[model samples]
Target: MTTSRTVPSVSVTYARNGGSTKSNELGMRVMQERAYEKRGEQYLLIKSPPASGKSRALMFIALDKLANQGLKQAIIVVPEKSIGSSFADEPLSKFGFWTDWTVTPKWNLCNAPGEEGGKVNAVETFLNSDDKVLVCTHATFRFAVDKFGVEAFDNRLIAVDEFHHVSANPNNKLGQHLGEFIARDKVHVVAMTGSYFRGDAEAVLAPHDESRFDTVTYTYYEQLNGYEYLKTLDIGYFFYSGSYADDILSVLDADEKTIVHIPNVNSRESTKDKHREVEHIIDALGEWQGTDPTTGFQLVKTPEGRILKIADLVDDEASKRDKVSAALKDPAQKNNRDHVDIIVALGMAKEGFDWIWCEHALTVGYRASLTEIIQIIGRATRDAKGKTRARFTNLIAEPDASEEAVTEAVNDTLKAIAASLLMEQVLAPRFNFTPKTPQSGPVDGFDYGEGGYDPEKSNVGFNEESGQFQIEIKGLAEPKSKEADRICREDLNEVIAAFVQDKQALERGLFDGEHAGGETLPEELTQVRMGKIVKDKFPELDDEDQEAVRQHAVAALNLTQKAKEIAVTGPDVEKGNTALIDGVRRYAMDVRELDIDLIDRINPFGEAYAILAKTMSEESLKQVAAIISGKRVNLTPDEARELARRAVRFKQERGRLPSVTSPDPWEKRMAEGIAFLARMKAEAENA
Candidate 1:
């Protein structure tokens, strides 16, 4: 029986995994209702298991929130365009006053010359409507400055779908984009997803700027806490961390009626690494190898030098959408009989993938996240009749292989599961590809049309005539865009916050309201001050330095000079800001200044070489100096003198000169060094 949770039904049908919505299957009613209602309580997280239906639940909540005065219009930034756009029409259309449009431009516009991207169309449409709801791909929403220009995608109510996608390591462009966008109070957003694989926490938290979320809720798929919604399905899984396919073959050799799934390999080791390990597992199966033990089909018999092949083991290259859609339907795969027994896999076939055929799974990757560990477990929770929960086994290479590390891995996996579950409170309907029909009545009002718009000012409105206050978004780029302004919003607000705290000073004309009296805040000092104030104000804002009013002043300047220098290398803006600040901090208060360029007697290579090459490898320069003097290859004094005084060329030539033309790479380098050295000697002699 399904728990109370209610996830949305795709064109596909879903038997409740385990967790059910507490009441009415909308908005995580039982758990998060109180938190949502109160102010300063917008950060509670909810956990939902795989197939627990979090997407649909969150969709309903988002729709319900649309009715609020705070959320008349909103933007959902779809990480994967295919998944988010699939449900854009119906559930969103339900709000009678809000219009929803998917902003992923349908491909294939060869015939139309004037079309831009889906972003352009969505904005134009939103401008035309009275109540606008925009759903766009991360590309369109995240890269607005480059794609549609800055003015196109600004929205007060915004939701970044599948936030976990932006959580992996490395400097991220999307995370930076979303972080800056979501930091505003006007934008009421919910980051939706079912995967929260952990990376460096500091980097991950830096992007969401968690302080901005009204509520942060978390739930775990394991232990089935707030996400008891997923427990109804018999959760079965196999664990085999650090175990080879060969090891698992040994264990599964005795079983029949099993379906094994594997993913395609990409690395250089792909062809041999895992395959070689399978051979070892086959040998370990001993007497059970290839005897069917059930139908007597001898499916896993090991030949002298061969590995065992389990029945129904296939590799599908398509994404979870196709693999899942197909697995959900066809029972017979690749000449295999209906009802697969054991599923084996790697890579894409691992966690986050849904496969009903899998009754038994081996955690062979040695080390995997807890979310991965549990996702593999949650895979078997389908409640199909006569479908028994598969047994789970973890493959371990050694009896005591760093239990502490394994424990941490499992804990992290569990934490990720909790994160995904909580995220599901908002994922269910949004991931809905196809909506089901109401048995009796017409649901026409379900497709709510946005009522009106003012494209120029991003003026939002819906049911204003009925006393409902709505916000509108302007259609085209303006001379001065809101986003450019919003980028500095936090800094401005913090300074304003400090100003509010000291309102008495403000009324006293703190050096004339418009202008500051103290010499304009030093470029470096402003940043130092701003970062300090902001850190003091919210303490939770991730990327922003929290000094009260200094950050505001720095933001006023188009990024400090230090900030510009750091940008040239392209890293997180805050890192650059910090670097700039640090650099400024290092400058001595009572400083010793030195001129970088001091004219000494020009180097032996003459002033010409000095000017021609400001910087080069020591060896390369030696070659240049040698070439001028002919020191390495004997030359007459007249020859050296002529080469030197005959109007030596002066313009600076960046980088190393042709080191040498020798056939050998190393030889060329050596020869060039000697030649430059000789030239330098000649220039010195002439000097």
Candidate 2:
């Protein structure tokens, strides 16, 4: 196999303080304790990373709600039956809690052997009975709500796990049911998810409905930093020319425990023969021995004499695949490092499939949504004893100039980049931005680095324990309403998700630069495009609130990119744990000032493009740019209006309208916007 030429787009090293794994008096970890503290809230949303004790967190809160809060019953809804295993009987009392969590065998409809339609009856029976908890899939819950109506499940707790499955779209039954439940307002609802945003860019909840829930957010930085092991997590993508299996071994290290998710049959990367592909992967590994009789795991001896126990979940044979699946999920071998080495799957092992020993999650194609990508990354992030580092690699097919589906290939490339960008934001430390003012000072717990809270300029402060950055940016807009403030504080990443996923913004940002003759200006994306996205997304927010959200979202995204660029290229790159924090401070110092305009002036995807250039072949990169540039259209009336607004703001601040001859690219672009509008007006009047 040829050696792979791929660099990690985002490599984050943690302090490994062991704080997250430590249990409190009630046997709750840090995140669980945090979630349990808000157990009394009628509407609670838990936004925590995978394996940060989200399962136990729900148990702790559900128990409290039942015993102390007068809730009659708890219905735990999960995305799939496999995840239902997470809510299985937990002996909390053995771990020093007041009570143990137990679900009646029959009431646990997920384990019931039947279609979801049949399980709705079990849900109805359980609701009528005195059982404290009933665990079922989201489907069963939806069907039950449909048959019995929302009022039948009153005075109970509805805990939706993997809550990102619900969407605010009217077509999404779960979201519609949730809205009805909230409108009824008799039941307490607790929603939990590692990714709150949908891959399809649908809102998880309506604004008015979302505002009612008290949010408990636990950052990925805090979870990974406090781990006892697993000091580093690397996320990257690789571009391959031919079939993916031939290039699989280039990035797949046999010794590390890994999950290889082959491309779907319809995906461009797939060779269309999954079984043969699996056989090919097995053959490439080494001489394959017979399947293990007891476990059904295919045993192979590498040339180095190491035996690799591989689980093949892609097989179409149900009995054989079931045995392999059962072997992987066997509780007796959960912590045994040698239980399984590699899991090759097509549609399994993604959401809630746990194998703590996984050191690499290699996916063959771009997943359908960012939520899936986050879930796949979570597979490799679980802290294990010997797993000091874990990485997630997306092996994608490079766009070929000879292919008829080159446009589709380019779209996949853009989507992959978008996923990478969002994951960086998700994994990095949270940012708390305030407008730089004379009254600004360092917060109580934050350390302002060497200079220690310089009031004369915008400063960057970091609170290591909380894994949050305190930033002051000049001319930053602050949200006026409580809902808007909550969004700015807690939902900036969600905003960034929508922004990066915007096709127009992403297309222009990635390909419209020097390769496409440099006609696209940064302000068009940062201001007009992003401005339109924010307005359409949160129509409830007024102009100032929208601008505030826009500024905060853009600043957070751009600063993270800037910090990553500094951290990776800095002189002290070896100190990866502190590189990001130091990079943020160093950037602020280098620029001499931090402001919204300066942040917006920088292309959010510039560094991404630089990384893309390094990874993809020069020829393939040019093909993608050519395909995107060919589709570029002239400015729309809406775009002109947005830029004209920015021009108005520019004139107010600089005492003159932007001139076409201005040396500044942004000023010249604003002038072009004015000219476009004027030309349109003249033509309309003449017509």
Question: Which candidate ranks first by lDDT, i.e. highest?
Answer: 2
lDDT of 2: 0.91
lDDT for every model?
0.35, 0.91
Query: Residue-wise lDDT of candidate 1 within 361-441, one digit each (tens)?
Result: 544422334334445555554333344434333432221223544333333222322222222221211100011122222
Residues 443-556 of candidate 2: C-alpha lDDT, one tens digit per residue: 999999997989898999999889999999999999999988999989998899999999999999988965345578787888999999999999999999999999999999
Task: Kindly report which residue stretches of model 2 are placed more than 4 angstroms away from their true locations once superposed.
Answer: 1-4, 514-517
lDDT of 2 at 65: 93
RMSD in Å for candidate 1, one decimal? 24.6
Q: Give Cα distance to truth, residue 631, candidate 1, Å.
A: 56
Q: Which 10-residue window of candidate 2 scores lowest in summed lDDT?
A: 513-522
